[model samples]
Target chain A: MKPIIEITDLYFSYDNKNLAINNLNLIIYEKEWVAILGHNGSGKSTLAKLLIGLLEPLRGTIKVNDKILSQETVYDIRRETGIVFQNPDNQFVGSTVADDIAFGMENQQISREEMKKRIDKYIKKVRMEAYLQHEPHLLSGGQKQRVAIAGALAMDTKVLVFDEATSMLDPQGREDINTLIQELKNDGDKTIISITHDIKEAMLADRVVVMKEGTVVATGKPTEILKDETLMKDCGLDVPLTVKLSQELKKYNIINDIYVNQEDLVKSLWEYSLIK
Target chain B: MGIQFDKVNYLYARGTSQEKAALIDIDLNIDLNDFIAIIGHTGSGKSTLIQHMNAILQPTSGVVKILDKTIIGGRKNRDINIVRKRVGLVFQFPEYQLFEETVEKDIMFGPLNFGVTKEESAIKAREALKWVGLDQDLLQRSPLNLSGGQMRRVAIAGILAMEPDVLVLDEPIAGLDPQGQKEMMEMFYNLHVNQQKTIILVTHDMNYVAQYANRIIVLNEGRIGFDGNTWDLFANYELIKKYHLDLPDITKLIIDIENKLGIELDHKINTVENLAQALVQALGGANHVR
Candidate 1:
């Protein structure tokens, strides 16, 4: 089985003085949901840019779908990968929501009818069909992100990368995006990579890759990695609020599973009561 | 030092074709020395409310009274500087606001703007740097050269150097990693506790409010959804759901367990330790009853 993403001894630097990324190595399987966790300037974003071909690696190679990443092949790799940035406002090139989604298909020289159908399709998928005619700047943060996602999804890219996409969203919006990402993973087709600060979101990913300074320090299942208090603290993150509450409820054995989501915790507590 | 919002109303892009009413008829008061946390969805008027506190924005209607004087009562062309000096606001991703060549100069900009001499501002800049846990040695270094976390701290020190009576930070830890978030939270806590400054933190992260804030204010559709302690907010599970916000996972777990097994676990758990103790007590009680 071939990995969807393969990075070996990949090094990146913005300037001669500071190497933004150390000799990092990573491999992501196809159809897997992976989250790269790190604080700002931890080089996760830089890593994301490198994967998408926005930034060239100073040393080493990145192979996506067995194609070695280089300046020449980057544009081709980008055709298969779609990235949504942290600031939705900066990513939008079209004035209206619909126009933004169509921009990708237009660049790909997709047929007019096919383009129109996809624009209609993804806009409704993100529940932003009503705002298709609205200007990007006029929308709220969540709405802008929804549009950004619509644009990305419309591209029909095999690999979807969200770079702190939910940071700008509110709680409800963040949850909505989380649910959407989970739904995408449920399809078991598209490979998903989300670089995020929210530990809860990381927990939802199949694997959480913790980055510090510029290299991958630890990578494992969310359940296993999230429990490490020292690693979490050192990474500039705190446990999910639900995890903390579950820890509190451990005395009663009410909330059984130590999870990142409060809803699961609540359901477990309810079940525990019935069995007891 | 208390800030009062007296039936304030504000509109975004007012008098323009795209205008939207963002804040509506807000009436609340925050006492001095309080660690107040505002939790709201984006565009819920939380930002509009905070902008009114320091007269950075004037209410389209109603009044904002900070330190007993109406924020909009004074002439905009005169004496507004005093109001700005009294309330130091750190906007989201505040690192973007840093522009000085060096950390020391950046921190001193606030005090120097208010007429502090160069030498005095340097001393105050050092004090502020110390307050945020930065070393004096980094003073001359360009703020751009510092780490992202350090750059943020430098931006905050600039605010602290102003020595504002009330410090307002909007989404201060929006995208930071766990460690940086903890350090920033501790810095805010220390500033409020050890330094005796009042704080108003606008955040979506309820964990911060649950762990630190003395009071929590919820905003929904430009109105006060709830204003109470963390315990009160968590206890009313329905409101949490209605607002479309998830309960901290642990609380949900306890509630779920209670529903499934019919056990009485503590409903007021906030931290991991509290939930753990509550779980033990409830289990013990259930065993005794059995």
Candidate 2:
């Protein structure tokens, strides 16, 4: 499959002194759900900003959908990609949910009729149709984030980047967005690059990319990346609880299989005890 | 007694078109040296409820008593500042509240405002910094130059310097990494255990609630949905689901194992370490699997 986003030799610096991203190269395939996992100041957010053209890289080339991203094509590239930030209050501009969803469409010079249809369709997609008329201040953090997602989806972007969008929400709110992301993935056309430090959230992705000090350290399937305790620790991350427990069981010679899901782990343990 | 809320009700934008009730009929009593975890979904009045502990937001129709002071709704209380001194409420993202030129001065600011002398406040600042595990070199450095975790520690140290009887925190580890989250939670746990301080934490992480808090309070739609220990809270799956709450990952895994095996396990097993031990026993001892 042709890659959707291609980055080579990416380097970014917040100040003239320290490099935030250093010699990073990544390729995300079409329709792939890629999770970028890292600790704070690991350059994951910097990479996301660089990909969406929010922050210019010191040295790198980013190509999106067969088009090389440059100063001239940056706007066009951004139109094909949308990002949801961590803070819902910081991203929300419109007073109401419908207006917020329409803000993105209006920037693209979409017609009023088309904007209405897109807002209706995308808000429903995020299960926020009931909150269409609600003010942004009144909505919960999760609801505001859902509206933010709707705003991103309304832009018709092929690649959606969530920059720790669920970090500030409650557990239920985080679960809500995770459910929405799964639904979006089921559609199988849009590519998702979620930048987060959440291990459980990262485990749900199709591929996991681990970063440390502004460079890619590991990249593979979720189970492969998360099962390596030392590697995860090197990247300043903790393995999921189930994975940790599975390792404990392995130490006791109870189960040999690496389990990521709760049910799978329990079922394997049950079988192991019954066989014994 | 540490704090009490008697029939408290809070209304946002009261008597207007946008009037909304945030907390309704809250009656709670928090004892000294108690570690309490408040769990709820967003918009469930968790923030509104905690603000009342320190007199940050007075009750609209009830009374809030902190220590020996009583703050009645719709009435002026001259002793509000006295109540505030006894309870230190740390808001979410507290690092953003730091504005001092140096870490030491920032931590000292809280104690000085509470009427501690300059010399005593300076001593308290150093003690607080040491308590939070910050190096002495950071005392002179600007807080803005520190890392996210360091800045968070500085802000938390500022609160600790106040030496309040009740420490209220709102999702104190919201954006921290897994390692930082563990370290910060452990710090608070130590403070609760060693200092014997009343710790009231508002968080969405069930794992933290299970691991740290002995008493759990569940809020649903501005009402007390459930109030009990962690074991009782986990056993009431229907109440948990109705409030859109979740079980700790280890607890959920243990429950799944019990259901699949059609056997009963100890409900007291909340932590991963304890659950692993319980599972070993349930499987007929450690050597049975081998």
For model 1, the interface Cα RMSD in angstroms equals: 4.4
Go through the candidates in order and give the C-alpha RMSD of each one to the true structure: 3.3, 2.3
lDDT of each: 0.83, 0.88
In terms of docking quality, model 1 is: medium
- Give lDDT tens digits, candidate 2, residues B147-258: 8888999999999998888889999999898888989999998998888878999998888888899899888889888888877888777877787678887767777788
Q: Count the backbone clashes (under 3 Å) in each candidate.
A: 38, 0
Give a tens-digit lDDT track for model 1, residues B76-123: 534667877879999887888889898999999999999999999999
For residue B41, model 1's alpha carbon misses the true position, in angstroms, by 2.9
- CA lDDT, candidate 1, residue A112: 93
Off by over 4 Å in 2: B17-21, B140-142, B238-244, B286-290
Best by lDDT: 2
Best by DockQ: 2
True-structure lDDT of candidate 2: 0.88
- TM-scores for the candidates: 0.90, 0.93
Q: Over 4 Å off in model 1, which ranges?
A: A230-276, B11-21, B72-77, B238-246, B285-290
